[model samples]
Target chain A: MADKKTKNVFKKGAISSDFIGTSIAKHQSKTTIGAHNIFLGQVRADVIDNKTVAAIEYTAYEDMANEKFHAIREATFKKFDLTCMHIYHSLGTVKAGEICLFVFASSPKRKIVFKAIEYIVEAIKADVPVFGKEIFEDETHQWKVNK
Target chain B: MTINVKYFGLIAEITTCEKERILFTKKNVSEFLELLYLKYPSLKNKDFQVAQNQELVSQDALISGHELALLPPFAGG
Candidate 1:
């Protein structure tokens, strides 16, 4: 359950819906997985001080971010009866309405996957060293903070 | 000891560089930060955490690693 190897959890840009669909299709052969839960984080067009955010440019301490992601994966496996889990986050610019984060968890049962998905997503939000720069419509920018 | 210090997010904006090598003979995190504060005083006003060798450590932790990072609030989803 404790996976020792670290995997890269970052992508260059927005995670395409097609990619997510392909991922799901690939798992069809794994008939042991009875349920899959997914969490997609879309960039929001937030209006702040009359400025609308157009996109988010994400960056990270890659070495630390990957290690933290690996730790979260290991913890999730140990805590749940999940068959597998995958997490991908955008590293560069992700436009508003585009997917920036994708989390998928599969399990033999439905309940485990539901819980596992939430746990992984929350851990990523709180522990990962990824930063976001909100680019406003006027080309101005501000750092994003997790709430 | 020369430490490879990394800055991320707004921390990099404040330092004006993403990475730098600091010649530090410090004993702990606080001492190393004090040295940094003298060089970049505005960093003192920023909210960030310290990571030594890719692991978060307290301010009193010993400077045992060759790499250090200044990380701001995480916005990861």
Candidate 2:
């Protein structure tokens, strides 16, 4: 069935503030949620070899990445008291200081949302197979590695 | 066997293609990797993990199914 493919978490470019705001607004109808914690991963202007980073071009092994996202989502729900969760990542180019990842977790209480967001973000950094190519201001590039 | 191999990110840059159907004579992971290194010598110097049917497998394990992937270090946020 269609559900077997898992929900695609990738967006075409940088995640706009408008889209994020709209997502939050849509949750107003669900009166059960009392707290929401969001983590936005912004691209840093990293300076390497005296060159400053201008942007990052991202790519992934789509099939495997999707599966991993699904697993992470499932695990987060199992371990936390979450009412809902949503994650979005950028594909293609995202400029320095732009948002590339957005993780939103909501719960009935503030404490649970805080813990849930951190866990999900850390799991994503360590487990997902997404690659980032850092493009320098001079147009040269190098691969990005999370520490 | 005709093994379907997929390369992502930096690995794909070296291989010059995203996917290929390689004519593999070997059955185990090490032999298959050796054969790949023969075809693309630069790949031997790169860092990656091998996935068999979407699961990471050790070099000593046997290759199963038709699909395999070369995944570089994860840089996801």
Residue A110 lDDT (model 1): 100
Runs off by more than 4 Å, candidate 2: A1-5
- After superposing candidate 1 on the true structure, give the runs of residues whose Cα lies further than 4 Å from its correct spot: A1-4
- Model 2 chain B is weakest, by summed lDDT over 10 consecutive residues, at B56-65
Docking class of 2: high
Model 1 per-residue lDDT tens digits across residues A61-108? 998999999999999998998888889999999999999999999988
Candidate 2, clashing residue pairs? none
Report residue A146 deviation for candidate 2 (angstroms).
1.3
Interface RMSD for candidates 1 onward, in order? 0.5, 0.8
